[model samples]
Target: MSGGGFSRLPNGTVVVAVSLPSPLGDGSVARFLVHAANRARALTRLRNLGLRAVYLRGNAEPPTPDEITAVLHHPDGLLWRLQGAPAAELWHPFRSSSPLRNRWA
Candidate 1:
């Protein structure tokens, strides 16, 4: 997770940037150069891990050394800079015996 290279997706394709919420609950985020077949699959990976993600516009291609360093050195992780319509903002509601799921189903 600490490397500058892209992470492989489930389908073995390559994407550029992915913004993942921190599992550590330290108010920090994790940014990855993601490898996915497409945007939906990339998002599915994060969603399965119970994470919300965004794609950074500038890093949507293979990141340069400076871009890698900049993301790593970012104070609040990379969530702050990810913007645009292509970004995925997924919300997983708390699991419970609530009737919402049944209604939707």
Candidate 2:
């Protein structure tokens, strides 16, 4: 869990959770997120984990090329930039379970 890499669930799913340090500072909390794989091999690794797919959540944004390189090189030095807004603004209130369903409709 301490390693800076993806983990597998019991269901053969490749889960890349962002295990960045806690307390991102400035009254905001850092959240761990699952990263998706665009490569077929990475997806296969997920399947090997006995999972059909991994669960990804939160308002985490995709890392930029430079950020990715930084993570690949020195994950411990990974630092994310604040967009100067609340994460809730990206999605509606999750009163119901199927929040995204209504969003698509």
Candidate 3:
């Protein structure tokens, strides 16, 4: 599971997740989710290279809106890396008060 998955939002933000191998049962899915978040950290490092945005699908819950907010607003979060132009705006517009118009605006 290295190729990972990509979800391009309507706002132009790209949500990327690591593709961890599923074990065989419920535990597999759970571990995949955990690994997804763990891999998110690795992906964060790529922000400096124009890969700032990511989305973690760790479980059926799809991560809380607040949890996502915390990640984006964290001191060293993705937002910090997307300061200028060209950074991948990896934010979820569905949770925002105003919806996004496209994925590359």
Candidate 3 collision pairs: 1-19, 10-102, 10-103, 11-102, 11-103, 12-102, 12-103, 12-104
Worst 10 residues of 1 by lDDT: 76-85
Local lDDT at 31 for model 2: 23
Q: What is the lDDT of every predicted structure here?
A: 0.40, 0.34, 0.33
Estimate TM-scores for all models: 0.33, 0.25, 0.24
Question: 50 in model 2: Cα distance from truth in Å?
Answer: 24
| 2 versus 3: better TM-score goes to | 2
Overall local distance difference test of candidate 1: 0.40
Per-residue lDDT, model 2, residue 17, is: 33
List model 2 lDDT by residue over 16-43, tens digit each: 4332222333553232223333324543
Candidate 2 residue pairs that clash: 11-49, 11-50, 11-51, 12-46, 12-49, 12-50, 12-51, 13-51, 14-46
For residues 1-105, write the lDDT of model 1, one tens digit per residue. Answer: 222234333565544455444454555544444334654665565454344334344433455554444444544222223223234542222223423222212
Best by TM-score: 1
Between prediction 1 and prediction 2, which has the larger lDDT? 1
The candidate with the higher TM-score, 1 or 3, is: 1
Model 2 scores a C-alpha lDDT of 0.34
Q: For each candidate, how many residue pairs have backbone atoms clashing (under 3 Å)?
A: 3, 9, 8
**CA error at residue 29 for candidate 2, angstroms:** 4.0
